[model samples]
Target: MNIKQYLDSTYLKTAFQTGISETENEIVVKNAIKEAIDEGFKLIMIRSEYVALAREMILQANSNLNVGTVIDFPEGKSSLETKVKEANEAIANGADDLDFVCNYEAFKNGDTELVKQEVLVATQIGLANNKTVKWIIEVAALSDKEIIQLSSLIKNIVISNFKEEDYASVFVKSSTGFYKTDDNSPNGVTIPAIIMMLENASPLPVKAAGGVKSYEEAIEMIRLGVKRIGTSSAKAIANGGNIPNQY
Candidate 1:
């Protein structure tokens, strides 16, 4: 297939499934995912803790679906070593893909070595266990220097990971739009950087996530070389905006 065809095939490949802890959502996001999957979404993302439960649910549905979970999640405050272990553990339990958040403070402080180390550890864990790892470069938190710096670091890290065959999908993400830095601009996996990263990384590929809420935006990300997406705006796209989320 041509690049355009490949792009269309993967775009919104399925509505991305999201999670909010039951405590965070008295309505429980798991139930929402179940309903979403039934509605014909084949790709879903949930908390690392719920990996096994999600696996069981998907298996019982007897449908072709891939389940994704996070590592280091919305926070990069956890120790790098801990993040790697969490990645390994999540995969062992049944995570089809890992969307990992990098240590933002380290990247922001110009600690390239630390950033590489964190990514290295997690990628090693993923490779060791045949798991997939994706680096979520929260694009919103960086200065232009930080972005360019971390991008090189990720390139190096991906090279290292590839040499060892520890490769997973790498993503330039926009949110956790996250905390820890005082910046709170609504960010996303920008089309330009996504293209640049793919042009540089070649076969390693990238996943564009966050703020992806429509068929138009999703297609743009795909056009920019993203092989995957993360969005809560699934129903909006699938039904021509018919089933609006009540959030």
Candidate 2:
């Protein structure tokens, strides 16, 4: 398999999250962007602040590598307006695709309308801008039933609100790679969780993110019907190696 083509080469660490200075964080982002260009990965997924820079770099290199950004990223607790605004700004800055963290907590709390509203508005913004939009439903934080519900929720919203031809642009992604677990367990995408997502979010593509560690694992995800694989280890995976860190 051409695993690099399925990879969304990712670097989403903030300065505060890494305990590094802003300059150090920029280096990490720049390195990922360079690798994506040199290696011909599918997309370079970065924090929104660097979308413009990544765009400029990709243009300079004359590569068709896409620039994707996260919205309401690791945390999905932001207000709907905040998420939509973030998405708009990222698109204007040259983001080709957007991965949004769905407000899974709200849906689990019985606030289904709020969850639906957030996704509806965000998906609209992306579709309007002719960009791909993937909703990150942190599977580790949800029960099996919640995964089914949220995955179907996103699919249903798109089907109801968008034309049939636009279905391919929306995806139900598996994780944000940053949710906390009580036992400090690996909270990344799991086979069972992805199966649930695929079955429930039918017709809409699924992206397996988080702990996809190697080329073999990525192949497994694609075989199971995942259309995208999000990982910081994309270069390693493409090289048939593995990285130790989850992100």
Candidate 3:
């Protein structure tokens, strides 16, 4: 099924959180890069601080993999200027795809302008750099109505501000994988949420992230029109196994 091509083999963790030293974290990152190269995944998504290192490793291996990073990460509350600067640095570090955490909290609060501005600025930066950009809406934290609305918002903004051909460079993605409900419910892409996004954000493409732990789920997500699958278990999925949940 060329499943590896659909995967964005990921490793995004701070040394503090993982309780590993910075050098240990890099070792882990390097292992992921090597695994990606050996397994032929389409991309390796890591934090921005490691973009250059990942890029160099991929280049050294003579692999055709893309380097990706997250911006504003698990929280979408960063100011527009900060997101832009982060994106710029990632680009300079050789990131080919950027998954940006959208300001859904603001949108839910009726501050649509803030959401739009944040998206517009990030999109502009990615497009100007000739890179692919994905807007992570953090679906597990939203209602069905909000999913449709936010997906539509991203589509509308990109369509109005960018050229038609550039539409392919933009994607409305499903989650940050870090969101949790008050009751500690699982957070990430669900079938219904992705269906809403696909229906509302037509022609803009979608990336399903989080909770995709097996080949079966990944295949189903692709069947439902997802262009990318973000998961730490890419290798496991490729081998028909499951790994612990990662965001």
Best by TM-score: 2
Sort order, lDDT high to low: 2, 3, 1
TM-score of each: 0.78, 0.98, 0.97
The TM-score of candidate 3 is: 0.97
Higher-TM-score candidate among 2 and 3?
A: 2
Sorted by TM-score (best first), the order is 2, 3, 1
Best by lDDT: 2
For model 3, how many clashes? 0
Model 2 agreement with the true structure over 85-132: per-residue lDDT tens digits = 999999999999999998888988999999988888889989999999
149 in model 3: Cα distance from truth in Å? 0.4
Look at candidate 3 and give me any clashing residue pairs: none
lDDT of 2 at 100: 91
Model 3 ranges with Cα > 4 A deviation: none
List clashing residue pairs in candidate 2: none
Task: Summarize candidate 1's per-residue lDDT along 27-104 as a digit string, tens digits.
Answer: 355564575566666466666766787788888988556677777767676888778788878888887767788887
lDDT of 2: 0.92
Counted clashes in each candidate structure: 0, 0, 0
